[model samples]
Target: MCVLKLKPAYKDYLWGGHRLVDRYNKEYDGEILAESWELSCHPDGKSVIAEGPWAGKTLEEYIRAEGKGILGENCRRFRDFPVLIKFIDAKQDLSIQVHPDNRYALKHEGQYGKTEMWYVVEAGPGAFLYYGFQREISREEFAQRIRDDTLTEVLHKVPVQKGDMLFIEAGTIHAIGKDILIAEIQQNSNVTYRVYDYGRVGKDGKKRDLHIEKALAVTNRVPLVRAKNSYPHVADCDYFTVDKLNLDGKMMDRMEGCVSEESFVSILVLDGEGTVACGKDGEQRVTYRKGDSLFLTAGSGRYVVEGRCDALVTTIRSQSAPVRIGIDIGGTNTKIGLVDVHHRLIDTVSIPTKTERDPEDVIADVGKAVQELLDLNHIPLDACMGAGVGMPGTVDRENGCVRYSNNIPWENVPLAEELGKILPVPVAVANDADCAALGEAVAGAGKDVSDMVMVTLGTGVGGGVILDGKIFSGRLTGGCELGHMAIYEGGELCTCGRRGCLEAYASATALIRDAKRAALADPDSLLWELCGGEIGKLDPEMVFAAAEQKDPAGMKLTDDYVRHLGTGIVNIVNLFRPEAVLLGGGISAQGTVLTDRLNSCLKAECFGGEHGQIPEVRTAKLGNLAGMIGAAALLVMEG
Candidate 1:
């Protein structure tokens, strides 16, 4: 058996997908024509880990730590490696969707969100893809068509053929139709603001959620048109630059480089075979085949991809300017702050999260909170950079819509568009965990590390990732969900309708629950007495106190808890092999009492202990304010 670390599997959504047949082989050698957006491949997992301790983990987990030893080392090096690669098999029509640009993402999705390209592997007769709206529809018209189910009348459809390519920028309304296979290279995120679907029913016979208002607000009506001859189009943006190359032979391309600046490249092989030749590496070439992609880290001089097939090449460019503010929203608070262009947080503030007693009342309350913050500071909305908020869960960040947030009563709420309507500024929204991870990466312990894992030890073990210095929000916002990760079979029950999850054993809530159980079973333990003679009164802090006092029962309880935590950590480390693992939330303050034991246990459980640099178990430097700081940082970078 291969002993390795485990990584979190957030959640996956099932959509209608078509099987693709390519020249590589037959059988499963087809594309997954995405009906709805499929995330969980980048800054999360582009490729699934099929075996080892990290088996079942997303690629994002493994990439975060840059292939460091499975969860036991804490080196400071951060590798800027892209963590996601996407596949689109256009067997049917996908919804007309658009992702926000980095500015839009940072403002609305709470992170950088755009810059994507497609490499066509196969196309059926007269296959076509949707790009932008056919014409600008009035807000009233857009809403009426959405109600009338005639959204297709307003979209522009472009014919696509084999070996064709397209570069999709943020704010562009686009979709993939039937009978084509593609490899989509994009910034790691699972945010999609779908404007229209073909009224397809789900397994339960319900139509997928649609956000017409938000989509119309941000969708580009006049997107760059592509035709039969649009095979090799290059799009250059402040956040990412992409070159779509349909190569029949070896192609040599020189990338613009700056003095002492590092550049990263991702070579995606959609069909055939190819190799990336580097001059500084002494003619060393990295080879790939169909459905294969490679992330080339910063190196000097020119590079060449000499191969037998066509491929898509993507590069990230450094932003030349700076923005000054970032904003983030969460279940309990709405936060705003200031940051520099390099994504550094300088200041922040937190306000109560809208009670959202009624789902309908939540959006306006949130907007009011944001406006109040700006008003109190006497900051002009136009003068400020950008705003980012963290919605509760499973949000469509691309269009700034809250698809569904269980804790809050929101269903297809147009959060970004609504905010923009009144704020006179850009707004981004993302899941809270994703925003926190962005914050930690930009300002906290992860500042210098590009690839790292941030897990919050709270009521639930929430997770976020920074891969290649960008937050990886998976498709459907289902990435880096550590709490739901299965650590044991037939274990404790989880809130996500599952059992044996890491959260069931390791969260602060879990600790309190177990402590209460221990107190009830023994009845003689000091925990009962400390809780004022009521077992129900026990909390996580009480357990922490008991452990600190060296109570035999408390020590045993903590050991069990820590062991489970260590196991989960081991699993994440083995999968991601990140440079470091930063533990956040109130529970992380347990300090060495927790870290020392957890680290020791992890070392015992990890692969190649002592030989490999162990991942450091450090508390988050930003504390509860991390989410706020991160949101602010995201907005500023985007603004």
Candidate 2:
């Protein structure tokens, strides 16, 4: 008999009480729904299910068959089950959140920060989903709002439908609306902060203990600029990626083997039903239906998906290059970095831009910037090859010129030429969005494979694209001006003179605008604490830091940003099926809360439709220096 034992997810709750405890053991003396840790253990203390007829065997018996027996190598978690699963039923709102990237976690958290997807099996009608908040709020205004109970005004309120799948990342501020049931798939770890609860009393008629300090340490409040719709992905690589197999009747999707390493594919049924056929000889088919998920182990070549409705498929494989860097240049700050190929940071530096009158003078100063950077690191100019710059205006990469500097007042200036004049090697200049994308591609999370997108959260939202291992410069407007994508028709006015662009709701500029507006309405908020009681004194960085500090106002602001972020990323994942989507910028620096929400949004918004492939979402590996390193990488590759 085939004996594969599926494990049940464990839950941890602060509001947990002993009603259920009485059924299991009388020794339990804790609050209802207190702390739940799900573990799958057979007799003899084995934690995982074995394979074949011996799959249910205890740990001792499985080990006894080390060299023989059906249990084999697949029976052990140490040998198999590369992914971990969990479920969280938050009776109250989680803190404004953050998570370290994989590299950071390996060094800090001891386990991978969770990037989970939630399936809302049950939620109250009119239940609101807390994703990200809108725009950057000044630190002072944020503080003030908490005192006045006006922080809720800043969040993106989405009425979640049952059966909705939502992806949440670490660093993103999210709260499970009152009364919700969820199914979660994520990197295995339980780390959370309680930013703000609805002030609801638990069954004990007492307030739940809040992790305010830890919550503040993690939140990103600059407002998240969510990504656009993702198109179907034709290829994928490790860490993880999903592809849409929209089949009306029968369709055969041929996957051409690229490298030598083995690969795994996962199929998720979003609608109707379908069967996945193996590429090898026997042509085995695995049948699945809506909400069903299956995996293909160590196989390559053409696989067919045939069904009544559409199906979404995902693949995970190993690849070279694990880092990517993203860069964004604003009017006030100029940043640079060196990152590993996988979106993880190696080194970084930032400086205030001279922002002098003449474009030439400002461009000429880049030489000094490079020299100063080199001197600081004690590295010779000859040792470095190239650099990437995210200019403030439209950039003509072909001619290395800034077509127009709407934000800084420059036109057709050779910013790259001036910087190159000082450097020993070459340099590439692009719009801030393109530069951010390249940074993500080279050293950010989407390192190994091509075809990916990056979003940078800043004073203004920016976007970039990578296709087939090269930056895709849109035929005329540069590649993927995602920030400009419309979220609401004729909603908020943007600096670009457009209405309801994603930037209007999710950028630092938007956050500040809303925060200031909220402060104007509520004068008693804690926001006044950070800004000396003056709304004008508010700063984006200050608000972001405060959010990490978990001030009520800060948490509210971050929560709003995360909600909008979820909506935007869902759209992007639906449009392009890239291997993975990465988030960067000042906002993403806060970490897991943002990443967790992003993963949740993908699952909630994904629909099998005619085609239903959803991509993986992750935070940028590099913190603030992705662009500088990515720019440098551009030179290295061109050289």
Candidate 3:
């Protein structure tokens, strides 16, 4: 009931060729195949369910039978299905066109606006497309240029190749150039305002109609200059969020992910083939190749992709607009964030954590700070679902007690009970590492995985384990003590009075400590030069920087560090066998440098090696805010 395979509604536009029919295996009788509405619910052309008992049913019919609830809470905001996915083949130039915004479209056309993104599948040599105007032009000039047949002269032509992605907002004049094929994800509406046709005639021997006035009214006169930001999403806007995935078959051939209750998932594969399954046992599995569209209902929970392919995953990140509060307690400062149902961190505030003060006084200060945070965002105290706190040490989640926290240097603090007394809403407390791991599982690097282990290599090697979409905090003492696990038998003294623990060898503090020793030992080495010949000035980055420079001392330090960390991680893999091992904290910023080495190390040292499912090593996406957002989620998540 969760997974659905679709058969597209094909279109034979005048400018199209048989590329889709010939190369893409589109079952079409026409000579030209311009577009295939791969996963549509539009009345103009609906995609039919292509398999099982639903074989002959249109997607709309299937939705009507299943009820709209299957679309997830987020889709309830829209009047109909929010998105339409298709594959477009432009054998010749498509007409320069524009689409109206929602307001205009709803008012004049009674449909949603068109805001689309194009993922180039194939581009022949010298292929180019008109994006927008090169420079801002007046309405009079625009009209005159079209009348004079000089419109293309003013348009911004972009030379395109395979793999390029372009986001086209409504009202941006654009045209697909000849010999280009692409996958398009857009609003469900098909309201188009063809503005220019290059004097082409149809079967009736008449030029295509152009909505000049409507196009003028909606068209953005100013040149569109797309500004790229640092957000991880491919195309994140109010309507939809898109993410690209690739399984190269060697390094990655399988992807395991979870579909939360907030949004349904639409995966449109652009290249390669593989099995797409829902649930752990593959009950709703489909063996599909390229040009396939797979839909997973909301809360499908566990979905797997096993194949060599590049696909774009589209989902609605926002839910029904419920917001929750999250608090992350660190040694120096605490971060507070608002998490909406989309599992995204909406807003964040920070305050210094004066641990030297009385615990009750500090708790009172946190309450005051929470009120200030709500007031600043113009949110009422009762507006939030609840508040969740992530503490630095072992947290008794059920009893809301801080049993023992070496970082906060506190024991037996009733955090949840006290915070609840003031907040007037449900409050949940959890270990800081657990919160980070949960956040990653819910929305970050481990968002798609059911089983995940997050290791935070910070001041101490902190870790959390996620099993089947929930935190695995074993006992009241806060289990999954990943860092305390011994790496070397009685080799090094750990801060927790343990001998040869991972925390003593794998943490950033440990790295810096070793760097300082190496600097003192080798006064003439690059480690000393990077740390300015001062042993006390040595930091973790200085060690990695020296290693990046290929210094012998730095190489030795990094090699030993990775070896020690790798041994501990290998043990984690052999034990948990999670889909991914997410690395967080300041040290994870090293990106591929650290993960690449660890993956290689895991390959060599893991018990089964390549014969088993090797967990991919990736950097945690949410970064420092993971704890805060994940803490907020605890108020809504199942234990």
Candidate 4:
């Protein structure tokens, strides 16, 4: 059964009383029962399974055994368990303390910061707790009050009653009052900065240490205005969503819901005696009562609770879904997107590459774009799996370096290492063409196919090979330079210092060069009029447009271009024989007009002509967004 009833770990502190043992049925022989770590998986204190096949095992152990998928999709976004639930019994006034925010706590304490909510389970009459400052105070005055042992003078002490809920955000100076039994749900961290301890001494008769300087540095010195959030749940945050569940023995005996694969469910029973049933058939059951904690793994299917109970049900929400940041670096522009596990582009932004600057400067600009995209989507850095970047070059994927990029002036740049310093998550770098192929394979035109290749005929004939759904970059990550293959050896001087490479004839740049030569030679043709009699003003679109009109120069250039492109396609088909040959980039915008002619040429000249079906040549569906999306998919593929 996925549902687990837990045995809490107990803590004995000086300010604690035995109320938890007497009232909540907590089993502890210690003189002072301060807190019961009910649903914790923290290294310091983890709850054990009480009655099940997994009995005697810690929650952490059970999770490791069952696999993380049980934690559901939303909870998986967190690196560790997202929450800690506990019962706090304060016989005497607890220490006045505050917690640092994640930024400070993670830096100083190596853990998440605490943002807790207290539900007054049992509060004695005349009981009050310190919440925050009564009014705004200067830093000097706050320090003076702390030094004079009069910090409580400025504190807002709110009287508490049973069932009242108070949220204590990190950095809010607060203390639990005497004679209070509270159920606290907070971040999975144990960093506390004590402001005052009532001059209390420990068992050794020494005064407990104070964190006055740290508290002063982190505490909010302003008055905290009380506000309540309205949602279907009791409280919702990026970390967790909490809902209240109340069942009466007579009328409401059962409650049920499905725990989706996105997040695990946590049940903290405040007051209850019931059997929780979980599983597809609802046969798996575990008995629970007051002070009992239960954990239900994500995707546990259906769960039902029977008998009377007052409890808090916590689940990770969709907004906390794990995502990856994908960046596609072009010569002129860089595009970034926040892509969820499903390959959906939730949010995107584009920034100028500014490649004239140093590679580090360009990477810093990309990092800023990444941060802005995260902020726009309200996604925490921890929620992202990592960042993936695709640039035009021979990328050393293992070292995360760009070996060389002919279009962008980068050579042997450690792209990932430099970007990682600026971003919070891990960074991965690959060739931009390889990323587009991956994008098309996972989410675009070739998504359904197993083996496919993407050929982007933009500035150059850039393409990538996918074999059995994985990138087929050969040894040293250098083999998939499809454009450099010599289609006409010793014929035309190519950019790679080779003669008559595929890129020299089939690329948009190559087509433009051919068009310029043709325009100069054919002065009486439409190519001259289209370029306004200047050979430098020629473009691929003008050549194709004139060809559609059957202009002599246009038709001749189009036929030669298609023949060269078709020969390159036939070579790829005879080699790997992918399921689909996807065409992308600026030229692909011409759509079927380009594809149809290229298909005809392939059918006429391919090696296996008239014997077998040729690979379907289609325009890429993701167009300009393909590179970024593909880069994002690399995280999922590699992970």
Candidate 5:
């Protein structure tokens, strides 16, 4: 049967007590029962099958016998079982330690790293755990504190209570405190670096080996920044997404869920008793209780859990989704991203532009980099649907050639033709701004609207108009040159040698230049403090930051920025009147600082005012890789 109860592997450590054996009904007779590997497949310890056809066999053995299809498509991406479930009963505090991230672990330990979530099944009064640092500290201080036994002073301590949950990602320094029982769901690996062990000796009469050097290298030295809203459920990472199932046996005592073909389901019961029935006829029934773990094969269809219980349900989300290659070419560097079918950038790599090199040589270097990326990911050429190129300057989409690009200093260069020689797949090329617009329209914030305009506020203000879900460049050439539109007659000189174009006043370059000029004028302003009186190092963000502090120069620069950029957007509204205007690039990082004021400005100054149907002004969802994703979307939209 697909649904089968499993037995746990026991662990006895120095700091552990008999809580697992006494309270949880573990079979272990040991005095110190530190951990129970409830749903594990690690080589060091594997849970054995307790019931059904695979009874008496290890989880690893059952998988080998039943074939990988039982594990589901999501498991296919992983070389082994991707999840490890354990019930940790700490009578004494766990050694202050950290786990390396995937890159570090794979290189040093030859395994994936740990990212775990702890559910406090039980906690003694006033129990607490260490989580990262209270504040950012220098490396020198961090080491000295460890040596002087003052590390706990800097550690961020979180009080524990039953039912509390904390996600501990790799590189986060943490430790489980005494008098706590934790159910940990993590990536299937055992690589920890103990930084401080409280001078505890092992059974061998020596202080346990501490991975101090490795811990120093991998530990995140700053305060932990938890990824906000990463998982609406219990916990989620690349390895697994865990959700809680609670049946109180009073009002709610049963739960019905479906197991799709994409991923298998693992249920680890922490409280109460229940009978889980699986399969089409619900013939497969398994009685579960506290400390019991059940595994259900993928595509097992329907399952029903009945009784009073609190359980952790773990599942993988994505399978082997098809990918597309996106190449975003810029002046200083070229970014290549592997965009999945969902339009998410699964991976990205960058190469220095080195524009001084010959065009062919530069193109060859990009080709080599793209190939290397594809190889590293174990993705074959044919696995990618196609390749898309987003170029900095005006591009002839029909011919896949960049007609002119001052950034690359290449004119009429056949970008697609050069890539086609190396990459054996269909290649599509378009202007980077247009690609950004298309990317947003197809997969980002503009995805909901068929008609939208994207304004990129970066080195130079760039815009692309999307009409009815497609990039509208107008009869092959002269269109969407948004920055060149003259905002003020006979004013600031633009890069195109025009007087007072939107780019001169609206771009980040313009902001930097204006901020530097303002800093020179207001010597005592926060702008001077921010750049340390070195006005040459002044950036656009410094100006906005100073404005936040009510500095005269910063406030004036920002106000003028709104006026000029707002004017350009108002013109766009009057011309096309799209459903939305998505603002992207580094300036957009200011978030609401740009959108709220610009929306106010657009609403007031537009031709129709309140009477007109104005577009919603929103931040672009795709951010920096918009060009790459959008360029890739062109092939899909056209195909």
Candidate 6:
């Protein structure tokens, strides 16, 4: 339902020619037409919606109005629109330049770095462009050559022709030569460091500026190896995948494909004319000719391009690739998993958590474990979208710090910042309980429901609340403490010095405590035999097992435990009224036995009982891996 035709913004630079305006039919009166920002959301030049109800608005505004989901699941990983497409016509050679990578750009330029690919639309005979160095050169020699204006002498020049594709990665010294028309697809960044400008003068009659120092720091001073990309698809990378579409009026007059929910489709018309039909019924049709650009929202169903044309179709592929690292930092161990956009756990690794060591040492070990996991799985650090850490206790998710962690001996620890220093990707930190809830909501049992609550009946009854498919951490990232809610006033003392907290009576530890006391009182009970007559060895599992055998004492303990837990569940249902109440942790392994009893309790005691549909009580499907998976989901949700 969301289809957009974009109008490009024109750019006129001193080295530009009028080919784009004269040949491509770009509307411009400038003496030189440098580039046409055909599809862009960058602040420097945003393309406007050429037609539709949202006409006259910028592409960014349209995306904001429609919600980013229309961009598709793949774009979910990016905080901003990932790609920028432009048509460039060089009348004169551009300055020798290099672009910094994300790490360097973010630090020095406060923006993303550029990694571009150019598809030569047309090139004059004997025309060539710089790619990299012709041979390996020392840093000193490179700098000397730049200073002496002999940098081009050592640069590798590749002759271009119609339909030639050149992929220019970040940190590669390159320049666009004269008499060449190029279609460039690149990251949504404008940071370029120029090394040599050939003493060209701008309109002001002053020599253009040079960023030699910064360029030298980032550029690769070595021979540029030419490699051929796959056919049909000229270039593919983390940011965008581009495919060439050449249809003559005979053999291939029409191209058809379903734009899946995974990524949006972008078509840039290079030549000829066509009618693009899209939507569920394919009723919406638009006439596109040379220089026309069209955007189809993700999950648009089916589309068809008919007529003779040479175009480039670019789509995002974030889902099919492994892009995120999920880390669950428990008290005893740290678990890491490589997760793809589809929520599949490709591989996982575990490392012991030496909580007794210094925080710095622990972080270093965690970083090392991550590196080992990547190396073992044959994944490059750059390929990882980002890293998410789920740690026990209160965490400042906004600041990526552990406000306080009783289990890990950490207080106000900058966990994300520390780990980011050692890892190539960005780092995010959150409460383990929150991560579990988010994980369930995204890829586990709660995937079918948008609103739900996860109550982890573990050592301390940790839990998280999810609202509208996002973790509800409340104000200051501390509100979702489901275990601390009071259930019985002035009763058992809680670990927080509070009376009758849910954790005091409903947690696994609480259940075990009660079971031990009961066994001590009734020595003939099955609980005693299950624990080998040793009261200290009694656990919640033994008590549940005894109840399953219809033992009186075990029945009583089970009933009381269920009643207390059900009371807590009832309170949550009455308060949030979520679509589902997911039970997690060790106790949840009991499955149906636990869920059936809890459902009964909810029917008997919850508000509005016996009327309307209550939340579905289910066990967490992800189990112990929930926290790690949820941590990875944070990158997508937050972005």
Compute each candidate's TM-score over C-alphas.
Answer: 0.49, 0.44, 0.55, 0.53, 0.62, 0.55
Ranking, lDDT, top scorer first: 6, 5, 3, 4, 1, 2
The digit string of per-residue lDDT tens for model 1 on 174-284 reads 888877777666665666888777778765779888776667666666434333232234555444456665666545333222111244455555567656565454354
RMSD of model 6 against the true structure:
20.9
- Model 4 residue 311 CA deviation (Å) reads 28
Distance from true location, Cα of 62 in model 1, Å: 60
Estimate every model's Cα lDDT from 0 to 1.
0.64, 0.57, 0.87, 0.87, 0.88, 0.89
In order, what is each prediction's RMSD in angstroms?
27.0, 17.2, 14.5, 19.0, 10.1, 20.9
- Clash pairs detected, candidate 4: 70-298, 72-261, 72-262, 72-263, 73-261, 73-262, 73-263, 74-262
How far does residue 326 in candidate 4 sit from its true spot (Å)?
A: 0.7
Residue-level lDDT tens digits of model 6 in 266-365? 9999998979999878888888999999999998988999999899999988643357999999999999999976577989999999899998999999
**Which of the numbered candidates is closest to the native, going by highest TM-score?**
5
Stronger candidate by lDDT (4 vs 6): 6
The superposed Cα distance between candidate 6 and the true structure at residue 536, in angstroms, equals 1.1
Instruction: List model 2 lDDT by residue over 457-480, tens digit each.
Output: 877787676776667767785447
Best by lDDT: 6
Model 5 ranges with Cα > 4 A deviation? 52-55, 134-142, 228-230, 260-262, 319-326, 330-639
The better-scoring model by TM-score among 2 and 3 is: 3
Clashes of each: 43, 119, 2, 8, 0, 1
Model 4: which ten-residue window has the lowest total lDDT? 223-232
Clash pairs detected, candidate 6: 323-385
lDDT of 5: 0.88
- Superposed Cα deviation of residue 512, candidate 2 (Å): 35
In candidate 1 the C-alpha lDDT for residue 603 amounts to 80
